[model samples]
Target chain A: MKTVYKKPECIGNKKPNSYCPGCMHSIVVRLVAEVLEELNVVNSSVMFAGVGCDGNGAFGYLDIDTVISPHGRALAVASAYKRCNPENVVFTYQGDGDLIAIGCAETMHAANRGENVTVIFVNNAQYGMTGGQMAPTTLAGMKTTTTPYGRDPKADGAPMHVCEILDTLDNPTFLARGTCTDPKNIIQTKKYIKQAFQNQLEGKGFSLGEIVSACPSNWGLSPLKSIDFINEKMLPEYPLGIVRDR
Target chain B: MEKVFMKGCEAVAEAAMRAGCRYYAGYPITPQNQVPEYISRKMPKLGGVFMQGESEVASINMIYGAAVGGTRSMITSSSCGLSLMSETIGWLISAELPVVIANFQRGGPGIGDIGPTQQDYFQATKAHSNGGGRMLVMSPGSLQEAIDAVFEAFEKANKYRTPVYIQLDGISGGMMESVMMPDAISDEEVAALKQKAKEEWAVGKMEGRERREIVGGADSGLPLQTLNQKLEAKYLEMEKNEVKYENYLMEDAEYVITAYGIGSRFARAAVNILREEGYKVGMIRPINIYPFPFEAYDAIDYSKVKGILSTEMSIPAQFIHDVQIAVKGRAPVYNYSTSGGVILDAVEIANHAREMMK
Candidate 1:
C-alpha cells in the first residue's frame, strides 16, 4: 500500500478542474487560503475574481465572500469591496488581459487613488482561459492565436511593462514582480504575495505584484517548456525585480 | 435643542448626529467638501470616527464597508465624484447595505464647473446607474429639510436596508440659513433604532452567526454570510413599501406640478402666485423617487388638475419621465429644464407653471 502526494486540504476539491496540467492556480489558491487561514481571516476575507479560469472559479472554491466582475474590472470591484468594508481583508487577482485591457481605467484609478487593496496581476503574455488570444502583455513577434502571423512588431506594441507603469504611480505603497515556474521562484513569489497583502492589512494603500507565469496550453509548448519560457524569455521582457518597494 | 445659524453642510453633520450616524468617510469635493470638514471636526468629539478617503469612489466604498460592519455610516460628494461612485452605489443597492450618500450635485459632462445643479435626478431615479439599477432618491429644499432629509434618509436606509441619497446642491447646500436643530435623538432611541435596523436590514456576518434565536455566548468572531435567497425576498419587500412623497394644494387646483426638493419649494411659491392670478395650481413633491409616489396620483383631485410641469436643472431630463408615468396621460407632463449651473428661481418657476395653466 502506498500514498501519493495529496493536494492541500484548504483547496476546495470539486471534481475535475478546467485548468490545463501544471497550472499554478490551484497552488496559488491554496497558498493564499493558507495565509488567510493562518491569519484567521478566511471568513472575513472577500476577493474579487477577474475574468479568467482562475478568476471565475474563485466563488466556488474559496468558501468565503466573493464577487465576480467583468473582464479587467477587478480593481474597481476590489476598491468598492475595501472601501465598504475597510476592516475586511479585500483583494483582487487579475490576469494580464484583465488588468491591461478593458480594465485599464479601473486599474489606474485604483492605484492612483491609493485604495487600500492588493492586486495580484497574473501576466501570462497571452489570454489563457480564452485559448491563447493576444493580451496586452503578449511579447513582440509572439505567436498567440490572434497574432498567428507571429505578432508583427509594427502592429503589436512591445509586451507591456505593467509593474514599471504601476511603480510610477505615487500613491501605491508596494509594487513587485515574481514568478512561480520553479521551486526557488515559488518561495519568492509567495513572499511578494505576503507583502502585498500586508500593505492592505496595514492600511498602507494599494500594492501590486506582476506575476510572470507560464501558460503551457496557450504558449504552444509543454508544461515544462513553458515554465522554461518564463525563466528564459518572459523574464527578459518583464524582468523579475521590485519596481517600487515601500 | 441647539439653535444654529449654519450652512446646509453644517446642518447635515448635526442631523447625521441626531439620526444616530457615528461613522463618516468621504473626500473633499466642491459644494460637498464642507461635509467632510464638518465631520472631521465633529465626529471625534462625539465619540465617532471619520476618514477623509482618497477619492469619491473610495469614499463611498468606505461607507459601504463601515455600514456592513454595523456602523452607521455616510459618504458625501458632488456630481463628478458621484459618477465615480456609481459602480459601488449599485453594489450597495444590490447588497441592500444601509448607507447614506449625500450628493451635492455640480455641473458636468466632465469638469463642468463646481457650482450648483440638480442634474442627478435621472441618474438617481433611473432604476439603473452602473449597468442599470435603482437607488432611493431624496431631495431637501430648505436648510432644515436638508438636515431632516439626511436623518430620514438614514432611518429609511436602515429601515429598508438600502442606500438613500440626500440630493442637495448650490441652491440647497450653499445658502446660509438659520435652523433650530431638532431634538437630539436620545442614546436609548438610537440604540433601539440600531437594534431594529439590525433585525430588519442587517444580514448576519458568518455561518451560524445569525443570533435570531440563540440566547447567549454570541460568537463575536465569525460574521455571517447573509445569503442570496434571503436578500432577494428582502429586496422585493423594500421595492413595494419604501416610497415617500409630499403633496401640496392639489385638492382644489386646476393644474398640478410634479416636483421635489428645491423644485418643489419653487413650485409651492409658483402655486401661490398662480392662485392670485385667477388660475389654481398645486404641487406634488415626491420624497422618494424610486418607489415613486404612484399612490399620490391616486389621491390627487384629477378632475381639477389638467396638466403637470416637471422642472430640473439637468438637460437630458430624468424626473419628467416619472411624472409622465405617474400621471399616465390623465395630465400631460411638461418639461422645464436647464443645465450648466442654472438654479430655477421663484419667478422662473412661477412663470413655467403659469404657462402650463394657459
Candidate 2:
C-alpha cells in the first residue's frame, strides 16, 4: 500500500515564503494552516498580520481573509474583528518586538477583557526585519545589533518573560510557550497552537500561544547552529510548558 | 412623540442607538465622557457590544476593525483625545471605511482648559488626518441639531463610505434641552442592515467567493495619485450635494455675519437687534464646515454689501480664510473672536457688528 502526505488546503500554493533562510515563521505558519484544515475552519478563519518580516508575508502564504495592521496594532484590530463577527475565527501573528515592546498595553488589555480571539506570538529574541535590535524578549546576555557588546542588565533591564507575566492574569483561558528548536519541539508547538484555536472555538475566551523561534541571519550563525543556540541559551530563560489554563 | 429633555451628550448617544449602531468603543474624557458612559450601560441591553479601550488610539483602531467588518460603529472623544486619534482616523480614510466620530470640543492648543472653545476649527475642517483627508464636519449650535446630526452622521458616513464628524463644544455637551429623539429601528431591521452590509462589502465569511483584503496603505496596487484622485472625486460629490447652511435676512443687507455652531446663535441674535434698529445686517450660519457654504455667499448682493464679519471662539480667528475666499475681495472681511472658552455675548457681538459697519 502507498500513502500520501499532503499540504493542508488552507495553505496557499505561494511557497516558498519570502522569509530569510532558516527562519521559523514559515514553519509556524504551516502548522497553523494544517490545524485550521483539521478543525474545518478554513472557510471562516481570518488572519491579522503585524509589520514584522514574518507578518508581512503571512497573507501570501495563507489563503484566507487578511488585514495587515500598523506596527503593534494587530491585537486591537483582531479584538474588534472577533467582537464584530463572533462566528469567524480571528487571530494575529505578532513578533516579540511588536507584542512585548510597543504593544504591551494592547496585549494586556485584550487578555484582561477575555476577548474571544487567539494570539500567535513568535519570539525570536530580536527585531528581525529591522536588523536585530534588542527586544523585550532578548536574553540577558544576548548580543544584537542594538546591544553592541552585549545586553547589559544594568542599563537595558532583564528580559521579560511574557508567559509568566500573563499567567498572573485571571482572564486568559489558555497560555502556553513552545519552541521550534527541533522536530519534537515543532510538534509540541503545533499541538499548543491547535489547542489554542480549540479553546477559542469552544467560546473559551483569550488564548495565547508563544513560540520561541530562531533568527540565523541576525544571530550571525548558520541555520543548524541557530537551533543549538535556542536549545542551550534560550530554553533555560523561557521554559517551554503550559503557563496558564483555566 | 413628545420631546425628551436630555443633555447633548446623552442625546448624541441615543441618536447613535436609533441609527442601529451595534458596536461602540471609546475612552473617558470630559464633556464627551457621558457619551461612552451612556453607551456602556445601554448597548449591552440592546444586544450590542461596548468596549472601554485602554486609550484613544486603541479605541479608534477598534472602530476601524468593526467598521471593516461591516458593523455600524462609533467613538466619542474631546479635543485632546481627538488629537491622539488623528493617526487612526487617517487609516480609516485611507481604507475608505465608514465610521462615525463625535468630538465634544474643549479648550486646547495644549490642554488649554476644560472650557468650551471652537479652537479646533482648522483641525477639523482643514486637516484632520494626513494625506489631505477630509470629513463631512457638521457643527451643531443647539441640542436639537446635535441629536439630529448624530442620526444623519451615520447615514452620510455609510452613504459615502467615509468617516463623518459631529463637532460640538463643551457648553452644549453639558447643557440640557428638549430634543425630539428619533424612534429606534426594529431589531429585525437592524439585523437586515448588518446582513446587507456584510454581503456587500464586509470582510466576513469569504466562503464561495474571492477572499477580501482591505489595506490602509499604498499597497492596494493603486498608485498614490490614483487613490488620491478617487478620494478627490468623492469629496467633490459631497461638496455638490451636502453643503448646508442657513441664510438669515440676507435679502437686503449691507453687512453679512458668517458664523457656525454657537457663534451662529450669537451672530443671528446680533443681526436681529441690528435689523430692528433699521440697519441692513444679516447672518449666514454654516452648518457644514468642510464643503463650506462658499457658494451661499454668491446670493449676497456684493455691490450693496460693505463687509463680512467672521465670528468664532478662538484667539487668533480661524475660519476667516474661507470667509475671505468666499467674499472674493468684493467685501472686506473682519473678525470678532473671544478666546479661553469665553463665549461672546449677543450684546457684545451687536456692538462689534456696529463697529465693523462703521
Candidate 3:
C-alpha cells in the first residue's frame, strides 16, 4: 500500500506528534492544516486550543491568533471571542476527555445555546495525554489503565455517546463524527472539517465534528493492531456519521 | 418631551431606543426580559435589529459580536443567566468592547430565587471580571432615570470603550410610572452619528487604512512611548467625558441620604416621611458610579450635612465606600442593606436615617 507524504505547507513543524506510530492523529492534523490553508483562514481565524493532548490543538504547529484555554474551557472561551468579534472566525479543537469529562457542562451548554462557533472533537477511547486512562468514550469491554478487568457497566458508568447527546440539542445545527482510521474515513473526515469551518465563516451556529481515534501503547497492541481495535471495537461503540444537519 | 407611564424595565428599553441604539440581543428572563420584549418590536419599527438568542450566555455574546461590528448594542438577563454570562463579560471588558448589560438582579448563591434583590451588586461592579478594568455601573431611582441611564450608558460605554450596566431590581424594574421622553433624533441625524462612529471603530471610518497607533507612558510598562501617550490621552478624555451624579434637596439639610436604583426609591420614600415630619433631610442619587461624580462630592457642603445614610440591596451593601471617598469623614456615614430576597422598605430606610441622625 502507498501513502501520501504530508503536504509541505501542512507539515506540523511542532515535532512528530507523540501519537502512536500508526495513529491517525498525524493524518487528521495534516488534513485540518491543509483545509485551513486552502480556505485562506489560516491567518484570520482565531483558534481556541483545547485541553489534554488536544490542549495544544490547532496542530499547535502553526502561527495563528491562538488562544489556549484551560481543559474543557476552550469552547466557552472560543464562543466568547467569536461572540465579541464575529468578524474573526473562531473555532476550538478539543478531545473526548477535554470536551466530555470535566468540560461536559460547557460543551452541552455551548451546543444547547447554539453559539456560532466550531468544535473539532478528537475521540480516542483512552486518555492519551495522561496515561491510557479509560475515557468516557471507552467501549463497554475496553481495557485500559483504569479498567483492567474490562469495563463493568455495573462498576463503571456507561460511555456517554457524545454525538447522540449533541443531536438531542435543538441548537447544535451540524453534528458529524468521523474517523481517520483508513483512506476512506480520512477523506470523509477532511470533508467534515472543511464544512465545519465554512459554516462558521457563514455565521452558522454550533457545528461540531468528532474524529474517533486510537491508542496503540495503551491498548497493548502494535500500531497496526490499534487500527484494528478502532475498526472492530471503537467503530461498533461510537459509529461515524452526521448526527445533525440544518 | 412626551410622558408615558412605564415600568422600570420598559423605561430602560425606551431609553436605549431614544439613545439611538440600533441593536439588541437577549434571551427572556423574568423582570429584565420586558426590556427586550418592548424594544425588539419597537427597534425594528425604527429600523433596528432585535434578536432573541438561544441562551443568556449566547445572547450576551451576540451583543459582544454586534458591538464589535460597531453597532450600539445591549444584553439583558436575570441572576442565573448573568452567571452564565460572567465569563463573556470578562472577555468584553478585556477586549475593551463598548456595550451595555441590564442585570435585573434576583436571589441566589445559585438559582436561589428569581425574586427581586440587590444581591448582584458585588457581581455587577466587581465581576466586571477579574481583569482589573473598572466598568461604570449606573443605578436609577425613577422611570425617567432608568430610561436616561440606558441612553447615557451607551454613550459612556462608547466613549470609554467598556461595558456599562444598568443595575436595578424587580421593584425598580417592574414599577410603572410616567417619564419625559426625549425627542427622537431624525434617522438622518442618527446616520450622521453612525458615520462618526468610524472615528472609534476603524471599519466605520470614511478614510485611512486600518492604522494601529502606539502611545507611550512612563510607568505604562509599554516601551512604545507613543502607545502610552495615546492611552494616557484616552484616559484623560474619558475622565472629562464620564462621571454623572444627582444632588437633590441637599442644601441646608443636616442629614443628606445617598442611594441609587431601587435603593434610592426606598430612600426617597423615607426622605418624604422625614420631610413631612419636619426633619431636615435630602437625598443624593448617583447616576454614574465609575467616574463616580467626583465633582458632586467636591461641590457639596460637607459641614452642613450632619451625616450620610447609605442604603442598598446587597449583604455587604455598596456606596458606603463612595461615602468614605466623597465625604472622607467630614460627616458621619451610616448604612442600611437587605440581602438577596427583598428590597429594603421606606420605613426601614427612614428609621435607619432617623437613628443615624440621633
**Among all candidates shown, the one with the greatest lDDT:** 2
TM-score against native, each model: 0.79, 0.96, 0.74
CA lDDT of each prediction against the hidden true structure = 0.72, 0.87, 0.72
Candidate 1 lDDT over B200-255, as tens digits, reads 54322344432221100111122333333444566567568876788777778778
Using lDDT as the measure, name the better of candidate 2 and candidate 3. Answer: 2
What digit string (tens of lDDT, one per residue) describes model 3 on residues B46-139?
8777777656665665565455445677788887788887766766665566788888888777887767887776677555555444577887
Clashing residue pairs in all predictions, respectively, total 14, 0, 13
Q: Candidate 2 recovers what fraction of true contacts?
A: 0.63
* Candidate 3 C-alpha lDDT tens digits along A156-223: 87888898998888898889989987789999999999898888888788999899887676677888
* Candidate 3 docking band: incorrect
TM-score of A-chain in each prediction?
Answer: 0.92, 0.97, 0.92
DockQ of each: 0.12, 0.68, 0.10
TM-score of 2: 0.96
Better of 1 and 3 by TM-score: 1
Pairwise lDDT winner, candidates 1 and 2: 2
User: Predictions ranked by TM-score, top down?
Assistant: 2, 1, 3
**Model number with the top TM-score:** 2
Task: Give me the displacement of residue A125 in model 3, in angstroms.
Answer: 4.7
